[model samples]
Each structure stands twice: as structure tokens, then as C-alpha cells.
Target chain A: MSHLTREALARLVDEMPDERERTHLESCAGCRAELAALTDQRQALATLPDLEPGPDAWPALRAQLRREGLVRERRLPGVAAARAAAAMVLFLAGGAAGYLARGPADPPPSLETPSRVAGGAAPVDPAVAAAAQGATTDVEASASEAFMVALDRYMAATDAPPADPAARLAALENIVLTTAEALHEAPTDPIISSYHLSALAQRNAVLRQLSGDGGPPVF
Target chain B: MTDDELVRRAKTGEEAALHALYRRYAPRVHAVVRRLAGDDALAEDWAQEAWLRAFRALPRFRGEAAFSTWLHRVAVNSALQGLRSRARHEVRETVLPDDQAGPPESPATLRLTLERAVASLPEGMRQVLVLHDVEGFTHEEIGEMLGIAAGTSKSQLFKARAKMRESLGSREMATEGKAYVASDA
Candidate 1:
């Protein structure tokens, strides 16, 4: 009876003691008293009252849960919207930085003509052309690349101006527009000189074409 | 509506079904949580949170157990989880003025002292107490619910009851009974 332990007392309180255990407990006066204590404990815990909720808590929790969205699900629109706004600002900032770096006046054009060789005009590097196209983030760099392309295309065209003044004028117009674009990108750049020169030459070619020069001379 | 139909409608985001389920089980959940924490406000918060959790998890309902049983499980679980969080209103630093709720010696104390005591018990013991005694889960059911041996469940129950006696008995839980120390033979 004195040997009956707490586990045994606990088992009896929960009513799970085996027949042998029960027989031992029956003979033990101490075990029976302990069992009564545990029974009383269980009874007290059973009677605790219900906790009613307050009014202000529901709306806050509902909005938070829905907006948080569980990890397994897609994020709520509120979060996504904020991220999108942030991305737009960064992209515009890049463009603004490029504009600021190029500053106020068009730079003068470079005199670095294609080094003439024996066989034919040197081939413009394709990599240089690609670099020019992607230079939108750096206004000066993009403008320089555009100038190179326009120069290369003009050099490759036949020297003689067409008899139709309109055809000649159109070519001059393209040069003028390309020059304006370059100047806008690097207002104070030296390269603007070459662009201005190209525009002047094309204007001369247009006057020749209109004067019944009888189509551009072959080659 | 039946649990199945309500669950299906809730899956489609029917506000009515969610409110219905809340009305049906909130009292029982509130009652169980109140017993576990002893704080009316915390119990209510957890009860509502349990419903919110149920709404979120409703899409996964495979109908394996009765809906009410699952809800009670979530409610108890939510209370236990709140208890485990440690940061959720740790024992108040300031004492409230004693009015009608009485002193710690009285069960009607304005500040519920039971929450801290229940939160103080070890996870295993406190959890079992919440399940069997207050939540009314049978030993067999708790065994199946928690995946422990039935004998293990009974032992845990006894140990938890003994611990609760110590925790609550400090003042508020003290009752007219001989103190019995739970021992493992």
C-alpha cells in the first residue's frame, strides 16, 4: 500500500489502471486517498467558465489575415501594388540620371574618320553598333553610337545624287533628323560638328539632284 | 446547413457560411479557451482566430472527421498556440484595481490569473489538460488526435492534471483537496 506510486495514483485517477494494479490500489489506503485528491483536482478544472470575445477585435484580425495571405497562396494585391510602384520609380530614375549626366550643350563632332585601307572601307564593328542601341541609359553613349551608324550608312551610299530633287531632299532630311537626335543626347559634345557637317553636305546633294543632274552618276 | 454544405459554400467565399460556423462553435471554443487561459478577452480573441483559421483551411477539408470536432481541435490548438507565443500579453506588469472581480484568492479576480499559470505549464502537460478536462475530448479521441499510445495518453493526462493543480492552486486554483504528487513507478 505504501509502495503504490504517483503514476499508479495518476493511472487510477484517469481510470486506466490494470486489474493487478487495481487490486494493489484496493489494498492500499494511501493510494486511495491520493486518488481522491487527483479526482478533486480534475473536477475543479472542469468548471472554468467560457471567455466571451470583445467587439473591437474582429475587423482588425480579418483584414490582417486576408491581406497577409498564407505563405502557400499568392500575396495580397496591396503588397503587389506597392512593389510595382517602387519598380516604376527606379526605371524613371535611371532615365533621369542619364539625362542629367549629358547636361546642357551638344559637344563638337569627332574628326576620327574611318582609316582608309587598300582593299575597301573598313568594316564597322558589329559589337560597337549593338553597344550604341543599348546605351539608352547613358544619353551621351547612345547619341555617339547613333552618329556612327548614320556616318557609316552615308559613306556606303552611292556618291551621285538622284535627278529627282525629292529623293535627294529626303536623304538630307534623314541626316538632319539623326543629327538633331544626337545633339539632344549630348548637347555640348564635339561630335555634334560631324553631324552638322553631314547635314550640310546632304543639303548640297539635294540641290544638285533637283537641277536636272540627270540621276546620280554611276558609282 | 450541414457541415459539408457549409464547408463547400465557405470554399466559394460565402460570408454567411463563415458567420454560421462561427455562431455554431464560437461558444464551445470560447468556453474551452476560457478554461485554458482564464482570461475572457484572450479567450474570445483566440476563439475568433480559430474560426479565421478554419475559414482559411476549409478548402483542404477532406471530411475525415466531424466538422465540429475539427473546429474544437483548431480552437484548442489556437489557444495553445497563443499560449506558446510568449509575447502575447505576458503576465501584466501593472496590477489592475480590485473591483468586483475580487482578489487572486477569489476565482472572480478582475484579472484572470489562470492564463499565466496555464501558460506556465510545460507544453505536453498543458496541452493534454486543455484537451481532456476542459475541451471534453475523450482519452481514446486524444490518443487518435495526437498519435500517441492510449496508455501514454492516460499517463500524460494524469501528469497534466497534477501540473494544473500546482499552477492554478498557487492561489486562484487552490481548492479543498489533499495535494497528491503525481509519481512515475
Candidate 2:
């Protein structure tokens, strides 16, 4: 009997041979050995494990989405929103106080040294935490979390008594508003631009002090 | 939700649905692209690009085929396009050196040897071998994806298997020789 060709064996490994080919294979030792080897090779190929992409894959994709305008830039969701609203209120109130404290021709009060807030960390929202965990971009997530922590600490600090309370409050409010605006425009930017956090914390410290809800200063 | 539902929602610009779909199929998509690209770095990029293209084209995906099948085709196309582009700058080179021409070290290591050998294959033959032998794509399907005649796909698979056999056979002999030396010692 004529021997089976390698092509025939290759096809046989992928599919069952026809009756004629099976009968020939039943009697052909060399063909059987070739078929066995090909089968083994195919099995080996099939058993290879799937590989994991680097851990940064999802975040990289998310970054790409932001670049493509597919997704909005990520922010520290719940707490950041609350902090921003509080900052806005303090800013507006400070502005009103500063305006009222100044005479029409009085120069703006000299800027006070920024104060810091200190306290136990606020609980991160579970949903945001879960999202960060699933993101597998822990480094990026942790940096955002750290910034939020700093902002929280600043918000909690005791406010020092201002020599000019109205003007000091007004300046703090301006800083809060400006920082909030910058964060709103570029939430991811704060990861690289930490000054915004410092400014926000300073305003929070002043607001806390004005409200008589002071904690220790972080800086 | 069903894949169809997710695809529909994704088409309507629901990013959550798109992410769900990605999470579901990314492993399989990455596996296919990795085998096709034969490089981990290239596979990740190709897999991501494939998903991006799939997302951009989701509206046109008329649910005639299963989503996985369609995604596989997209990944294959992405990998092949990358290979073709890279081929322009790359000089063709042999996969094995003269000194390492022996058979695999042992039967236990045969699988690893075969995997390395497959990754070392020239692009055309490697695609055919992987699509047919590993990925279970039919010659007809491979031909459609690779834009060649089915006969050419078959011819390539045959040549690919022959080269693999030669390389593997040499390794097997070398392994046997190593055993003999060890036994002698």
C-alpha cells in the first residue's frame, strides 16, 4: 500500500481521516508513528497557557480613552465631590466677608501663611475603592488616594485667628475657588501638580478654624 | 447580560457595557493575538488595538456571527497588519543557530521546545501552523483571514509542520544522547 503523505497526516490530526485513509493507517507502522507525533505536537500546541498582559494594561487603556475623549478624566469620586462643594461655599462666604471688611479704597489685606488640616482619614467610598481595585492600577489609584488624604487633613485643621478675619477668610476662599476650578478642569493633573492640593488644604484649614471645628495642623 | 445586549449597549455609547464586554473577552482575544504575534509586547498592543477597532466598528457588527468569532477575526487582522508593517524594517533571519540544531533536551521538555520552535517560525508559516494546528481555524477560514487561497494555506501548513518536525526530531536525538552520556557516567 502507498504510504500516507505528511499533508494527509496533518489533516488527520485536525480531523478524522476518511475510511480509506483509516484502513491504510491501520496497516502502516511508519504512517501510524508519523500520525502519533503530529498528534502529540498538536496537543502540545493546544496546551500552551494564555499569558497575562502587564498590570498597567487597564490604566493604560483608560488613559488612552481619556486622550481619545472616550471617557472623562477620572477623579476621586465621592469625597472629592463633597470637598469641592464645601470649598466652593467657604470661598463664596470668604469673598463676601472680604468685600464687607474692605473700604472701597483699602488695599487687599496681605496674604496669611497657609494653614494645614489634620485628622483621621475619611472612609473611602466602597464603590470607588472597588473600582480602583478592579482597575489594577494601584500605583495611580494610591497616588490619588494620597492626595485626597492630604486634602482631607488640610480641611480638618484648626483655623488660626486672623488679625484681619474678614480679609483672611476672603483670601482663603479665593484660594479654595481657584484650586477647585483647577481641579475641575484637570483632575488628573493634580497627580503631577500637588500645589492645588496644598491650596485646597489651606482653604479647608481656614474654613474649619472660622467654624471653630479645628484639628491639629498637618503642615 | 447577553453579548448581543452588551454589543447593543456598547453601540449606543455605554462605556460600562463596553468595559463589560472587554473584561469578558479580553483573555481570549489576547491569547489569539499573542499566538499570532509571537511576542508578548506586540500581542498586548495588537489585542488592545483590536478591541479599540471593534468598539469603533460595533455599530456595524450585524450579529450574524458570534461576537467571539468576529473579535477573533479582528485580532487576527490587527496582528497580521502589525507583522506586515514590521516586516518592512526587519531583515529576514533564520530561527535557529547551527550550534543549537540538536533535538529537544528531553520528552519532558518537548512542549517547551515546540513552543519556542513555533514562535521562531517565519511569519507566513507560523500563522498557518498556529491558526490550523493550535487555534483550530480551518484552512478555509485562515485563507479568508490571511487573504490567500485555501490551497496556499494548506501548502503553508504542510511546509510549517515539516520544518517543525525536523527541528523537533533533532532535539529528540540530542536529548537521547544526553541520557546515554548520563547513564554512562
Candidate 3:
């Protein structure tokens, strides 16, 4: 038998050999060896294990999703309302604390020319600083409130004991910690805000699942 | 739930359904990205990008193919785009010459050797070999994904396999030599 062409061998490797080439393989020792080697190579290639992302991969991807707005940032009206209420409460608490800490006649600490603005020694307008501080406080409060409400709702919704109470608690704790961290680093970033909100919502869903009211944990 | 059901919910912006889909397919997607990018950091970025792109494009996913297939294609595209962009700015790293000359000792060792060889292949050849041989994409599909003709894809695959065979052959010899030296000692 004539020697098989390299093209023919390549075709055989690709599983596209013609009828005549298929017949050639039966009687040809050299071609058979070549074919076997190729098959082995292909098999070795196929058996390469799929690589796994790090265990924290889902949280990273979830953050990306929130940044992209693929997942809803604002899940529930109640959650939002609770966040707002929480922000208001935090503002009031902070204001009262400031008032009590200051002496009765300390002149209310000059609203017009208080120190420490970014990049310069220029005094910030009291009104602008108050607004900025209020916004920051609101964001922090919203994140905190959202998490608490979600946790409270989840606790109320579940009837039976959780299947894995430790894991459930760990997940809740993680959400709280991650939200707190995000708020501390980038309190005003919408992406961080959305991520904070989503984490709470995800925890609520898990709680619902544990309580038998929801379907499954998102992760 | 089936991917179809999950996809439907994901289209409506359901976070749980999207998470379910991600959980189901992320390993496969990460594997493709890792093989294509040949660097863990780049692979992670590419995998994340692929998922984001998939979700953004979800509404247009008409379900013509299996979700896995569609997602794989998306990953391939994502990797290819990153490669193209990187190619434009980054200097190509030189792949070390293959010097070993014997058969591989075992299947497991051969697999590890082959992975190293594949990672060292030139970007174009590596992409063709991976898509064709490892991922089981057809020359036509690879051509479409890489924006090359089918014949070009075939040519690249052939060159890639030849290089892999040479590299693996050398590594096999090196492994045997090491075994012999250890035994003699």
C-alpha cells in the first residue's frame, strides 16, 4: 500500500478522513501507529482538568454584576424605605451627640469657616459641608438599615431551624462585614451602594429559603 | 432549574437566577479563559468580563443554541478580544525552546507537559489548537471566532499540533533522563 499523505493523517486526526484513507489505515502499520499516537495526544489534551476560580469568585462576580447594573440594585421598596429611615436615625443620633459633646455656648462651631477641606486650607461653607456629611451619613445609614431589615425579615420568615445554621450565620456575617467595608472605603460610590444593597437582598433570599418561603440561595 | 428557565428569569433581572447560571457554568468558562489567556490574572479578568458580557447580552440570547454553547462562544470572543488588544500594546514573550527528545513517561505526566507546551505556543497557534483540539470547536467555528478563513484555522492547528508534538517529545526524554539519573544514584 502507498504511504498515507500527511494531509490524510491530519484528516484522520480531525476525524474527517475519506473512505479510501479509512481503508488504508487497516493494512498500514506505520499509519496505524501514527493514528494511535494522534488519538493519544487528543485524549491527553481532552483530559486537562477545567481550572476553578478562587472560592471567593462568586462575590467578585456579583460585585461586577452590580457595577454593570445587570442585577437590580434596589430590590424592594420596604428595603429602601428602611434604609432612608435608618439614615435619618443615624443623622439625628450624630447631631444629638455633637450637641451634647459641645459646651452649651461653644458658638455652635462656626458653620461658615470650619477647617479641613480637600487639597487646600480654604474653609468649606457650613451649608455645603453639612449637606455632604448628611449624604455620607445617609449612605452609611442606608447600608446599615438595609442589612438589618433584611436580616429581621429573614428571621421572621423562617419557621424551622436552618439546615446549616453555621453556614447561614457565616453568610449573614459576611454580608454585614463586606457592606461595612464597602461603605467605609467608598460610601458614596453607587456601585458600592448597589453592592451593599444586593448583599442584603441576597441574604434575605437565603433566609427565605431556610425558612422554606424562598426557592434557593443565589450563590 | 433548567438553564432555559434560569435564563428567562435572568432576562427579567432576577439576581438569584443569574447567580444560579453563573454557579452552573463559571468553571467551564474559567477553564476556557485560563487556557486562552495563559495567565491566572488575565484569565480571571477575562472570565469575569465574559460573564458580564453574557448577562448584558442575555436579552438577545434567543436560545438558538444550548446556554453552555452560547456562553462558551461568548468566552472565546472575550478572550480573543483581550488577546487582540493586548497584542497591540504588549511585547510578545519569547517561548523557551523545547529540548527534550524522548517519549513521555506516563499519561499524567504527558498531560502536564502538554499543558505547559500549549501555554508556550504563539498566541494565534495556541488559540487555534485549543479551540480545535481541546475545546472541540470546528475549523469553521474557530475561523469565525478568530476572524480568519477556515483554511487559515486549519493551517494554524496543524502547526500548533506539530509544535506540541515536538515539545512533548522533548519533555518525555527529559523526564526519562531524570528517572534514570535518580535510579542510578
The top-ranked prediction according to lDDT is: 3
lDDT rank order: 3, 2, 1
> What local lDDT score does residue A112 receive in model 2, on the 0 to 100 scale?
19
Q: Residue-wise lDDT of candidate 2 within B30-103, one digit each (tens)?
A: 87787777776777788888877887788799999999889878877888888787678763433333343345
lDDT of 3 at A71: 85
* Candidate structures ordered by TM-score, highest first: 3, 2, 1
Cα lDDT of model 1 by residue, B104-171, tens digit: 55556412454454556665666677678766788787777666776777788777655654554424
User: B1-185, model 3: which lDDT tens digit per residue?
Assistant: 99999999899887889989988998899988878887667888888889889999999999999999999989989988989888978734433234532344664454456667788888898999888888988888898888999999988887776666655552332232232111100
Candidate 3 deviant stretches above 4 angstroms: A1-8, A15-31, A74-80, A83-219, B91-109, B170-185
Candidate 1 lDDT over A151-200, as tens digits, reads 44343322323233443454455555554544454455444544455455
On TM-score, the stronger of 2 and 3 is: 3
RMSD to the hidden true structure, all candidates? 22.9, 14.7, 14.8
True contacts kept of 3: 0.42
Order of the predicted models by DockQ, top scorer first: 3, 2, 1
Q: Worst ten-residue run, lDDT, model 2 chain A?
A: A111-120
Give the DockQ-based CAPRI class for model 2.
incorrect
User: Could you tell me which residue pairs clash in candidate 3?
Assistant: A158-A211, B100-B170, B101-B170, B102-B173
Scanning candidate 2 chain B in windows of ten residues, the lowest lDDT window is: B176-185
lDDT of 2 by residue, A23-129 (tens): 99888877887776766666667766555566776667766765766642334444344343333333333333344334335543222111111111332323223
Error of 2 at A124 (Å): 28
